[model samples]
Target: MNSRAAQLQAFDRLLTIMDELREQCPWDKKQTMQTLRHLTIEETYELGDAILDNDLEEIKKELGDVLLHIVFYAKIGSEAKSFDIADVANEICKKLIHRHPHIYGDVKVKDEADVKRNWENIKLREGKKSVLEGVPKSLPALVKANRIQEKVAGVGFDWEEPHQVFEKLREELAEFQQEVKSNHKERMEAEFGDVLFSMINYARFLDINPENALERTNKKFMERFQYVERKAKDIGKSLQEMTLAEMDVFWEEAKTMDKRF
Candidate 1:
């Protein structure tokens, strides 16, 4: 069979297995959307980690896990006579087609930036009261900041240049320093938030995703830390017993070895 047909057949098999599990597996039958919410979030992070690690096999497996969650949710909805898998697929298909007017319609887009601008304009035209309305409240703070900036920038509200964003970041940092010196707890917290927000804006100005940047740092730290642990074990010293100087040596070595970053 052709690739598309093979994919469809695989999807059909997954759906069939889901149906059997719902009917015959006690654990699967007992799952509710509320219970699965955290699992879905965890699966998403696993997929992200896989992507960041460049582990295609892990990414494929994690994607299947996420897809199973989607199908499971659809199955639950079907049981309740709310909606089915086809409805879920149709909704996203319609959304994709609607959003890509430049692809499916005669809308002219000069570049990726223009496409983003058009997307925001189309979303506004779709009756959304605010550009920020679609941002999930549960999103990580850095990601939320990035999304908020992008949404506003879509409508022409943004810094003219990266230097302008950098200046703002510096200003916020100065204010945060002042708050720290004054020991005003509440004001310090607010200023700290402003500093982070400005940093996120600077990240956006440079066409960098703050969340992905942070995640990459997180992974790098974990890898270096594991190296430290392994080195300490090899030398017959526990991590807790290792000196700061010794750990720093291993950390610097890790930084040198991790040339890809």
Candidate 2:
């Protein structure tokens, strides 16, 4: 681990490199925040995958990538005479101090929920029109739904019990089933979305991140299916040539292998 002084020196080195690149490197020089936006998003997902895999080395590398993107954006901001890295860093520092009254002020909190309630209330006092105002409009539906539930919950707008959330989920499922029976395509779609929203809320009550859980299942399925494909190829058979039973055998093997690993 680096000392605090060493850490600050390393960050200064990064800023120097960024400045050189922005001045001398043609690609870096031509880059704007808008031009780097999609790349930043891709790097973020890479970091997410690293975190999910619990790969410390990969996580460290991804963090550097993300930090570089931050520096790049800050450089662009400085060039435009808008703001620089210090301004960006200070703004968040101020926000954190303001929001955490329990830590920075005389406010007392009994639990994590109390802290959250204070944070949301502070945001409102900071001139936010609604609790949901901070949730990005461009977030994926599943992630957005979770954020919406969380923000409202922070302000005490939530079910009193986990079982109540489960009951709502069940009700939504019943409505979805009714829509399916009616065979109205549009209504069924709407009902299906409601079911998903309810499920996300229920997952929140269970302390599970629905996005991470779903992505883990997706990765698991891909690995197992790929294992099945490899087994079929070893026997000189394509997946299309393998019967369901044959694939199931490899799938079972993959499951066993996963358990061992």
Q: Pick the candidate with the highest lDDT.
A: 2
- The TM-scores of all predictions, comma-separated, are 0.93, 0.98
Taking the tens digit of each residue's C-alpha lDDT, what string does model 1 give over 16-116? 99999999999999999999999999999899889988999999899999999999999999999999999999999999899999899888888888988
Candidate 2 lDDT tens digits, 133-225:
999998999999999999999999999999999999899999999999999999999999999999999999999999999999999999999
Which residues of candidate 2, in runs, are more than 4 Å off? none
Candidate 2 positional error at 33, Å: 0.9
| Model 2, CA-based lDDT | 0.95
Error in Å for residue 208 of model 2: 0.8
Candidate 1 to truth, TM: 0.93
Q: Roughly what TM-score does model 2 have, to 2 decimal places? A: 0.98
- What RMSD does model 1 have? 1.9
